[model samples]
Target: MDIVTANQLKTKGISVIESKLADKKEIIISVRGKEKYVVMAIEQYNYLRECELDAALNETRADYQNNKFITESVEDHIKRITK
Candidate 1:
């Protein structure tokens, strides 16, 4: 992880992005001495996003397998709620 000030990020946006892509690194952007944002390569971002989705999906599947799922479609569930 690399840290960059917000002003530096604004001025050198392209280089920062290129560096992260070339090195598979992440940049933490700071604003007023506090961490504000993360800069990562698109591929890395996508990979992490997919991993989060997979983890959520696995949790959902496990819950369903344990008979913890609600057996209702959206429409039926809504109708039941409105009744």
Candidate 2:
């Protein structure tokens, strides 16, 4: 990962990130010498989001296989979650 200071980002703007991203998948934004944020391309972000959904789907499948799921009405589901 490449680190960019907050000052550099402010002075140089998104171009600084765009240039670094040419060779890197992600860039870290540092504030006061400490890492505070990350910047990445939209494609990479979407890929990660898909990976998260896939993991959730796998977990749900496993739960179903183990008979760990419940059947309930919509109102009951809402009430259970809200509680």
Candidate 3:
């Protein structure tokens, strides 16, 4: 991963990020010498979000297949979960 200091980012702005990201997928932003943030292209962020949703969908399917869900009225579900 490429590393950019807070000072560098402060002075250089998005151009620095754009240049660094030209050939890289992501870069780390360090603040006070500690890794603090990550910068990535929007496509990468969206892809990750889609992957997260897909994982959740798969987990929900597995739970259903294992008979781990409940069927109840809306009021009953609300009461049951609230308790």
Candidate 4:
């Protein structure tokens, strides 16, 4: 991880941030003495989102395998939910 101050960002412009983000990693942006924000490449953010979805799907599969889920037809689900 790398850190940059709000002042530096203001003075140096986004080009500096763009350079740092070239590796597709996160950079910490601090305002005052506190670390407040993160900067990352779009690819990194998308990859993380896909990874989160994959994790959720894996958990759902595990639950189904362990019989920890409910079963119903799509019409039954719609009727139950609509009620």
Which candidate's TM-score is highest?
Answer: 3
- Give the least accurate 10-residue stretch of model 4, judged by summed lDDT: 15-24
Q: On residues 1-83, what C-alpha lDDT tens digit does candidate 2 reach at each position?
A: 99999999999999999999999999999999999999999999999999999999999999999999999999999999999
Q: Indicate whether candidate 3 or candidate 4 has the larger TM-score.
A: 3
* Candidate 3, 1-36: lDDT as tens digits: 999999999999999999999999999999999999
> Model 3 has how many clashing residue pairs?
0
Q: Which stretches of model 4 miss by more than 4 angstroms? A: 71-83
On lDDT, the stronger of 1 and 3 is 3
- Evaluate residue 31 in candidate 4 and report its C-alpha lDDT on the 0 to 100 scale: 99
Give lDDT per model, in order: 0.83, 0.97, 0.97, 0.91
Query: Candidate 4: deviation at residue 39, Å?
Result: 0.8
- Candidate 2's displacement at residue 45, Å, is 0.2
TM per candidate comes to 0.76, 0.89, 0.92, 0.79
Our tally of clashes for model 4 stands at 0
Worst 10 residues of 3 by lDDT: 16-25
Candidate 1 Cα outliers beyond 4 Å, as residue runs: 73-76, 79-83
Per-residue lDDT over 1-46 for candidate 1, one digit per residue giving the tens place of the 0 to 100 score = 7777878778987786677557655878889999998888778789
Q: Give the local distance difference test score of model 4.
A: 0.91
